[model samples]
Target: MKKYLPLLLVVALVLTIPGLNLDQVSAESVDDLNKQIKDLEKEQLELKEKQDGLESEKSETEKKIQENLNKQGTVKGEIESIDQQLDTTRANIQAKENEIAETNKEIDSLNNKIKELKEQIEELKEEIKKLQEKIEKREELLKDRLRTIQKNGGQMRYIEVLLGSSSFADFISRTAAVNIMMDQDKAIMETLKEDRITVETKKTEVEDNKTEVEDKKVEVEDKKVALESQKQELVALQGQLNNQMAEKETLMAELEHEHEELHEIELTLAEEQEVIRAEAEAKKKAIAMAERKKTELAQLNKKEPAANSGNPNGIFTHPAKARISSHFGMRYHPIFHENRLHAGVDFATSTGTPLLAPADGVVSKVGVVGGFGNAIFISHYINGQSYTTVSAHLSSMSVSPGQEVSEGQVIGATGNTGNSTGPHLHFEVHIGGYGNPVNPLPYLK
Candidate 1:
């Protein structure tokens, strides 16, 4: 023992060196894990704050959307009311047009009657002219008779002439002559009186006809004017109703556009919330993993070095028993209709098909994750390197966050949820952590 004193000192010195001591290295690794946990916690807090803000924004957007719907209802009602008014106005206009048409017909009839009356008056005037010529002839005959009587006997009477008659035959003959002359005069006067009465009657009839026609025409004209005025009023009312309807329709369109925009904003905010939530969940998983590793380091004799420098093919296994439907790369998105990164591999399968874990991992997130729908995220450690696997668009989840799962363990059932086109599993491999998506085809067994 005395001869091995130097060797004992060398052994003690080797143990005392910090690089060779297992506990020291383990302590340093634990410190690093603690720092990682603290940093993850800080990031989680920030994510939580961001999630709260996104939620508030989403709530406000939903409120606005509801308000827009209410306003749209009101605008639609107003439009309906305007439509009713337009219908009524159109009916009224049609009725007014009918009235005007009837009035025009009446006026036309009255005008025709007035024309007939004018013709009748002209005929009466012709009769009056013939009667005037007859009266003139009678007057001339009477004047000639008076002139003859004055020339034959200036002061002699018929009675005195008869008394001076020489014989009875002469007296009889004179009486006969006087009787004949008187008869001729009486016939002439009778004819003159009848013509005057006839002329006066014709003049009165013509005047009466003219007065009746004029009255009827005036009344019909008044009715026509009134109808035309009413029609104009109705037309003006219809125009106003149409304008109101147009305004209401425009308002409805604007409201609908605004509603669509609000809905889009709500979706965007919801997506943001899901992103923040996923980030927070990722941070929590990191903390848990670091804590678990720190505890394991305290008990283990030595820590294993990272193998393969984070190579994927040696770490992961096939996640689902299905054929590959799509590979991770830039492709035209079926839903969004744009060229974008696929970000994952799609496994074609039927709905409710079990989704297996790609490796031994802890479930980091289990819920709706934006477009992923009922998705699950697993935090994996492969040969001391961090990795993450995502199982998205799930119909159901069997594992919850923070639950440990082994390789080939069922974590969920695949379905067509979120942005998927059909029932399939959208599986992603992130070599470092979340948000770093890589082609999972090369990594799968």
Candidate 2:
């Protein structure tokens, strides 16, 4: 304002009338200045309202930004947990598959062993059959010998043959030949009996071995079946993990969309703040012109006095009777377990607890606004400067836009909506302009 004052003074001098008395000129100047001051005051009111709206918007956006940051942290942690579980599930499935492969190989080996045992048993059966046949043939020959001895008077047959031979050498030859024949028959019978016993013992051993291999095959098959079931369970777990990851990703997308909205609001708020500053400067210049004209009029009259206007700036009061739940600025979030800006101070309260307006103001906004849930924005002028108040995370609001509200008026109700961990009232104050928040503790008292 001071930067443009010299120029304004120079312009005033150039516009002074040349052929009139100072009193006449002063009256004209005062009337024109009065009109200008009225226009500037009207414009000032509009600018102040705009400034409050933008400040409210910026505060809300910052709250949303903080909420998204906390949400992102939570979603990312869930995703990481799902990833870890997926790794474990996959490893378990691989192990089961490996076990199944080895079991199949063992089953194959058992089948081969069983087949070999069966072949060995068949060979032993063939040996036992041949031994039985040879024993039967030898028994048939011995039966014929016994029949001949009985027909020839049993023991006397050999003696009669010796007597009928009429020669000692012929008798002795017959005796030796008979003795050799009987001894050879006895040896053949003993050999056949021993071979049959040996073949039967070998068949028993082979049969036992076959039974053992078959049992092993059955056991291994059972193990494979159990392993398959385990693999299926692991696969099911993998499916559950995939679903969790998808849900987390969807939540992250929503948070990102919210962050984008906040970015747009921030940009718009910055531009509006600049506009408000320019309008304030214009209002300042208009006030200066009004003062200049009043001075001139007073000098001409020499019998005037000016009255001081009372300041309309109001004081702030507590909006609720709750304790501070969360403070403004950076802190570790409880749910997300990560550091993030809190943006607004949270007042601990039960759900549906009514909130009050801190000062006389006009409600600028009343609706659901992202993480703030049901919210209210109020515009106020304090000490000739613009400020905005934001109340968030409400279950219900009782006010509407452009509605006049007095100090301690019920505006909304507190709640645990959006990204909150519990029921609370989120309150913020943006003084002068927008963007960074100042500590609202002094005002909340």
Candidate 3:
């Protein structure tokens, strides 16, 4: 009977030990899972902070770019105005140059005409001198012929000799000789008269030539006066043209300078845009990584029992070292000039402060949001229930979407961002795609 009692006690002890060991294993696994979830939540909070920071930086860059564009537009308008002025000035200068050329041609023609008139006048003077010499020679010849006739007794003796001739043939011959002498005297007189008349005619022609030369000289003087006037006018016009050319040159130079400045500004803008694009791409990649991690955590949570999944009382740790500057609630916006609902809490902190995760979780979204600036969202599990936490208005981010993060891990810092009055972090708790915005104070310990 004693042997049978010992065997029964041994069997009972073996069954009890196995049951207790199974219970202990279950409890240990639940605790370990909870710890991991808290760590991941904290990591997610840190990533949210980093995303907020990036968004703030992007906003500032956009503002600066807009201002630069406005300035460039104004410069372009000024350049266009200058270009028009330059064109007008150039046209005026060209017209002036043509006028000057025409004036010079007119002066040259006038000078040539004056030279021809002078030559004509000189030829007329030489003709008048020749006529005067001929007249004087003819007058001397006439005086000599009259003196010979008087010395021959006026020729009455020759006529009587011819009339008293004894022979008829001698009388006839004497008569013929007398007649020839008379005819010769007549021819000499006629020649003298003709020479006198020629002299008178030549004198008259010389007077007419003198009168014409005087008129020509007067005309030449008038032409010279006119040319001088034209030359003076041309000089004045040339001066105006020179001034216009100088003005045009100045305008062109200014336009060129403006063009260069615009080009430089465009290059700067392009570089800035490239930098912004790279930063945005990096942020997007980070968000994707965070989402992947959230999906993995969700799968893990699904496999666990509800009681062993996560914190059931909604207790979460603070994500970073930051002071709350504004509480989540309805608030007045300065720019909008209206009361609006503030979806998150604002935390004031120094630039580049380290941000930490609030609980164990996975990063879900990380990127820029318009009003929130740079922002990040983390998905966390609490007793089989999933919740998302958002952080905004940060200067930079350090984590990516789908990345696993533990509690209190560094992810980003706090900063002032879009629609912000000061440096602070905006934090919020969301469930089911922002449909429910819960109080962060209730969830965070």
Candidate 4:
């Protein structure tokens, strides 16, 4: 009997050690899960910050691109105006050239007229010289004739012979003829004066023509100088226009390049933002699923307290006096239209339905929660087994966290709050705030 007792004690000790080992392993697993959750949360926060920065950059890039586009538009308008001005300047230059050409043609014609006038002046001078020579020779001949007449008149004293005989009648006729010759000499002198007057008038006409030619040459030279100056001005204006056009082209090119770059950047930012948004959405969904799973696990662990505790026979009361509208497990949701696990039981109840504590417990949490509205959580012990229960979708909570309450005490009121199709109570049970959900029906009945 003593030998058997030692063997039994050894077996019992071995069994206890395995249980202890299992407990330690469970604790380690929980710690690891907690670490993973914290790490994921930190990653989510960092991702959010990155997304924000990306969004800000995207907005700034878009603003820059818009500004560049506006500047480009303004530059294009200026370029158009410059083109118009250039065209106008070109037309004016052409017109000026035409004017200059016409002026040159007129100057050429005037030059020809001046050349003809010079020729006429030279011809008039030759004619004046020839007339002067002829006058000089005639004067010489008249002088010789006058001297012969004077000498012959002195012999006229022989007229005394004419008075002595009939021959004297012939001598008297000769004296009368000599008197006519003297009158002829006086008429010749008057004709010579008239000829000299005519030559002087021809000389005066030649001088006037020469003066007119000189005036014409001076006018043509002035016109040429004015046309040359106009051409120079036109050239300068053309150069200025060319420079302006070149500058405008460069500016336009720069703006276009900047705009294109900005557009590319904007596109990149947009794509990045899309990626960030997708990631954020995925993260949010994952987090929500994890939270739901955590709650479900806690509920399961609560119901299956025998798995961790020796006491297997324990019971808990219903959290509220309500009829079950929806059961746990997979069901098609009317709104979501997909197969989903109803993590908690849904109870159909009137608004302001009183929710009682299912067991003697201390309130662990009381606050408004997303998708649950006002909620209350209670921590309790049954046969040395710790458990937690939650009442969600409540209109109000009457107890504060850490407040003790007896079983059957009203802790909250049920209502249609947060993601509810109707007034109802969403109830859950948990053990150690972790582990899978267990069937609550076994405990309620």
The true-versus-predicted C-alpha distance at residue 437 of model 1, in Å, is: 20
lDDT (0 to 1) per candidate: 0.73, 0.69, 0.58, 0.65
- Residue 298 displacement (Å), model 3: 40
- What C-alpha lDDT, on a 0 to 100 scale, does residue 57 get in candidate 1? 84
Stretches of candidate 3 off by over 4 Å are 1-145, 148-155, 210-214, 259-445
> Residue 181: error of model 3 in Å?
1.6
In model 1, the runs with Cα more than 4 Å from the true position are: 1-44, 150-184, 278-445
Q: For residues 1-445, could you state the per-residue lDDT of candidate 4 as single tens digits? A: 9546434433333333322343444555445444444544555476567668877997898888888889889989988988888888788788878887887888788778778877876776787788778778768878878676577684453454345445656766766665666566676677678779988887787677767767876777787788778778877887887898899888888888777656655664554444334433333333323332444435644664432233334455677776788776888744225785666788888989889887666665566654566778665544334455778889988897557666668887999886677889988776433123555665563
Per-residue lDDT tens digits for candidate 1, residues 273-345, read: 6544654554444444434454443433142322322333345666777888888899864423578787898
- lDDT (tens digit, per residue) of candidate 3 on 355-440: 77765666665666555667666655554444567777778888877665665678888777654677777888764323257767
Per-residue lDDT of model 2, residues 1-445, tens digit only: 9666544643453354334344555656556555554544565676678778878878987887898889889888888989999998998999999999999999888889888888887887887788778777877876787798888888687677656765778778877876776687677777767777777787788888888888888899999899999999899999988998898888788778767656655754765465356435433432343243444433433422212212222245667777777788888644345796766788899998889887666666677665666777776644344466778888888887666666678888889776577888888887643334666775543
lDDT score, residue 28, model 3? 53
TM-score of each: 0.51, 0.51, 0.34, 0.47
Q: How does residue 113 of candidate 4 score in lDDT? A: 76
Model 2 residue 166 CA deviation in Å:
5.8
